[model samples]
Target: MRKGFLKNRFVRVKLPALLFATVTVNRGLMR
Candidate 1:
């Protein structure tokens, strides 16, 4: 129960930011 709630929160915020940062870094490397 508690784990599920934290997982949802992570997906809502942390996951997107993490993915965005990774993408940006990849783009920078591509340059």
Candidate 2:
């Protein structure tokens, strides 16, 4: 359970960066 909690926290930390990267890629492709 503790391991899963740490994994979830790691994802929560990374999710925004991933999202931002994807959005930037899409915008670049659109241009």
lDDT of each: 0.93, 0.98
* Model 1: colliding residue pairs: none
- Compared to the true structure, candidate 2 yields what TM-score? 0.68
Top-scoring candidate (lDDT) = 2
Q: How far is candidate 1 from the true structure (C-alpha RMSD, Å)?
A: 2.0
Model 2 residue 25 CA deviation (Å) reads 0.1
- Which candidate tops TM-score? 2
Worst 10 residues of 1 by lDDT: 1-10
Model 2: per-residue Cα lDDT over 1-31, one tens digit each: 6999999999999999999999999999999
TM-score on alpha carbons, each prediction: 0.64, 0.68
